[model samples]
Target: EVVRQYKLGLARHVNEHTGRPLSRATQTYFLVALRSLLRYWAMQGLDVLAPDRVELGKAPSRSLKFLDGDQLRRLLDAPDINDLRGLRDRALMETFFSTGLRLSELARLDRDHINLRTREFGVIGKGRKPRIVFLSDAATNWLGRYLQARQDRWKPLFVRMKGKPDLAPGGPGMRMSTRSIERLVGKYVRLAGLGVKATPHTLRHSFATDLLSNGADLRAVQEMLGHANLNTTQIYTHVTNPQLRAAHRKFHSGNRE
Candidate 1:
């Protein structure tokens, strides 16, 4: 009864950050932590409710924030390609959308890690798992242009055009940090006037959604995104289901609507 009451209290608990009722996921997190503590106490011979007695509420479906085709095109075009920095920015954005790589994964890349001819490379993603990432022709073209324009030996795939003293021709200091990449994405997001909050991860979402919408397999997407579990990749299915329904409506012989 105490556990039931506590669950009810959590349901009504207000979040200090959002000024709203605690989300089901957050409630689950709290409950899980409490359950672990209870289990620890029980192991120590203390009289406490069994952890199994604490039932978790169902979490709401995830809402994905991704750019649509038009928005993506606009965002990609946001950078001034004629300029060196702009060219680098364009390449970075293109690579993000093409590879569906995490910000850290992209930032950790080196020039030697990529193969322009094959347009594919291996990356160590979450959990230290290695997966292959492929580059689109556009990404390849932009990257080639950016690298060619550099005209210097830089080991890092992407580097700051200007800032900080020049250490060596191939030094880690020249590499762009993940935070810098985030700010770069934000700058273009504003310039594109997307009217939607987006980050580098948004491009990853867009990449997954774009593939699924165009009939790519879910498992394939999971591998491409280097997800540890298929369930993590399944979140994108919610975004693609509507497109599937539309396709069914158009092609199904028994369609009445």
Candidate 2:
């Protein structure tokens, strides 16, 4: 009866800031946490409810958000290349689109990690799994230009250009934080007038969607995106399904009649 009441309360919960009902995912997360706590208590011989009694409600499928080609072009051109900071921003955006790297993985990059000649590098993604990420020619050229303009020999591939470097032992030394990269991407998203909220992860989605839309094999994209399971990569298929339908209608022999 207590668990039933708790479930009802969660279902009726509202978001304080948004003034909307709590999302299904959020509700499920709360239930999962509670279940874990109950499990621990039960293991300690406490008279708590059984963990298996806390059933999680199914959450709706997540909507994948990505920039279209025109939006991507506008964002890529948003930064003024003449300025050093602008150059860095352009390179950073290009790399995001080129490599589909998670924000933290990109933030941890060092100057020596990339090979401009090869246009490829390896990154440790979620689960501490390593995968190879490739760069586009455009990304490579922009990165080369950005590196050439920098005077300091900072070890980090991307750095906070606005601040002075800390040369102290174990200091970050102008290394760009993940938060800074998030803000940087947000700034360009506004400048480009995308009229949609986008983050660094949005570019990663764009990268995956763009490839799938262009007829790249799904399994290959799964590898590039470093997804632990192919099911995670399958989410982008819905976004490309319309294009596939259109192509079938146009080219399929059955449509000739």
Candidate 3:
């Protein structure tokens, strides 16, 4: 009875306090926190509930959010190229889509981390595991143009312009934060009129889905994504309903001549 009450209370807390409708992801996080707390108490020899015995809420499988080819084109073209900020924005968004990097990973990159000649770079992903990510030709080109336009010798690959164009390169004010990258993504998403919620992570999702949809091997994508588990990468395998219908119509026995 106590365990059941605890579960209900947690669910209520999520719905009533967290937000309306309670996101499945947030519910899972709440459950995880509860389990961790239980484990800690159990270790201290408390007569509390067993952590492993607690049931986790099942999250309904939802379609992954990603920009289709047209949307991607529109977003990539949304940034203006006529000015310094525009050039940097173009390169930043291009690099994001090309590399599938998490926002923190992308924002923390230093100029030295990139090898412009090879157009490939290494990033330390989750768990401090290092992996190589390659840039598309378009991404490379924009990055080159952005770098050429920059007069600052800033070591950071991307920097924030603090109101003054004359700020010295490599100064403390030049670094871009993760929040800034999120806002930038939001800005372009609105500008492109995509009518979908696209954070910087959406570009990452698009990158993975694009690879998977084009017949890239699952395991190979797992490696490229730096996922610790193949199951985590499997989520990208879900295709749009239209693609499912097309496949069914093309290959089903009933459709055969």
Highest lDDT: which candidate?
1
Residue lDDT tens for model 2, 110-216: 88888888666777787666666767767888999999998877788898977676887534567899999999999998899987788998888777656554434
Instruction: Please give each candidate's TM-score.
Output: 0.65, 0.65, 0.64
Give the Å shift of residue 25 in candidate 1.
14
| Cα deviation of 132, candidate 2, in Å | 0.4
For every model shown, the clashing-pair count is 0, 0, 1
lDDT of 3: 0.69
Which residue pairs collide in model 3, if any?
154-170
Across residues 83-153, which tens digit of lDDT does each residue of candidate 1 receive?
Answer: 88999999999999888899999999999988888666778877676766667767888999998888768
> What is the overall TM-score of model 2 with all chains considered together?
0.65
Question: Which ranking of candidates, highest TM-score first?
Answer: 1, 2, 3
Better of 1 and 2 by lDDT: 1
The order of the candidates by lDDT, greatest first, is 1, 2, 3
Sliding window of 10 residues with minimal summed lDDT for model 2:
248-257
